[model samples]
Target: MREWLKQLREEKGLTQESVAAGSFINRAYYSQIENGVRNPSYEVAAKIAETFDINPARFFAGKISEPFTLALKNAPIVVAHCDLELKYTWFHHPHGVFTPEEVIGKTDEELGIYKGIPELIGMKKLIIEKGMPMKKFIVFQQHAGEKTYVVFGEPLMDESGEIVGAATVSMDVTEE
Candidate 1:
């Protein structure tokens, strides 16, 4: 429990004081909780979870090391991981919308769907700067038709422990 709190707090780049300020807990009290000297009530737990944008259940999920479980079948979605140079490293096309070859070496500017979405660039900037995940709903139209995608972007870190880029997964949620 202590390790989880420490790891998450560090990953978020927040000091105890900062987290306390955002959570309305005293710095010393938060320190005690993180150090295992104290256990927070349900109200405090909920507040902490909200302040961190974390699912409180995750802390007690127990023995489940995996942070997420997602299906990548023929689900009409496109997911991609990009390097700092804006080159794609990995991609998953659940709907067969576009071939991997088409997006592998291209930046967002070179991609048809994202070419003019300045908001996406802003989202990337926010994710990279804050080292957190962001989600938004986007509309796009292709040869087939128009669709709505629930896009999520999270910072990706490299070996030396520095954020290099991001991993994004967009799922089509429009009703057919």
Candidate 2:
């Protein structure tokens, strides 16, 4: 996969279909790039970058890690990760509800809102320190209304099995 704009798309809360609509490539091809199943050519990556209003080189600078499981194309999810210092490193795809910036470079305590703060804090701590993976359902109350999300968190481990960061995947389960 291209590893370029997946995280960015998640950040901007843009769906594959919407982002690829007017671009040269289609949603399937773009999904291939995002899923790490194929790599985009320089021209393709550049064209895609142009459509997203980001510099082409931005795609080349960093690689987006494929977390536990990628949400289906246009799937409602908000994924995030934090470093050892507990600063938000990756915050993307907020299911069209929560603010993306609320999680970026900020801790749960820092946000000081959202339901199940203690559970989230403990989950993150265990993942970052002990490399535990967890999955559970949680309810969050927002000004819009209350929604339940199936949330998963795990330690982002390195090649040596050392914990580096904490990763989270959240899918809205209110309908379920």
Candidate 3:
């Protein structure tokens, strides 16, 4: 669901009908968008953003950029987003170690892939708490043997500039 959108509406004390009217959209459509049943087009997203006085780009936060997509396809890189609690919210390019289903809603500690290794999780926590970007190199002993990765993490911010989560990109460097 677009939980953030719903939270924003609730924060503003706006009903679905009011938000729909303000965005020039049907209430049912707005409801569908908020419930994650339908996606808003750029124009509709812009209208809704205007109604909420937020950047229209907020609606596209989940979208991966073209370069990122290309890198995911051609490189041994993993990208993920985690909530403030360190639970995975979105993940891609698992590099044959895990799947989206295995990672989402779970923390690194829960996965056991980084068990006893605090640097990766610590970096994410630092990013969320301090709203800063950081990079680290970590090693993991997997069934395939020892693998190293260079991980970059940055804070994910809401429309009001509050840190809500952390986004990370990790590239395997074991062969380097």
Q: Pick the candidate with the highest TM-score.
A: 3
Model 3 accuracy (lDDT, Cα): 0.81
lDDT of 2 by residue, 1-176 (tens): 44335666776788998777846789998888778787778888778777765435434433443342343436777777777777665667724543544455457787775776667777788777777888878777766687887889988765797786788988877884
What does candidate 1's lDDT look like per residue over 1-176, in tens digits?
A: 36667766886899999989999999999999888788777688777777766545434433232232145554566767776665554566745655554555456666754532566666777877888999988776656776777889999886697987788888878897
Q: Tally clashes: model 2.
A: 2
The pairs that clash in candidate 1 are none
Model 2 lDDT at residue 24: 71
What TM-score would each prediction reach against the true structure? 0.53, 0.54, 0.60
Q: How many angstroms is residue 176 displaced in model 1 relative to the true structure, after the best TM-score fit?
A: 3.5
Q: In model 2, which residue pairs have backbone atoms overlapping below 3 Å?
A: 10-92, 10-93
Clashing pairs in 3: none
How many pairs of residues in model 3 come into backbone collision?
A: 0
Best of the two (2, 3) by TM-score? 3
Candidate 1 — what's its lDDT? 0.69
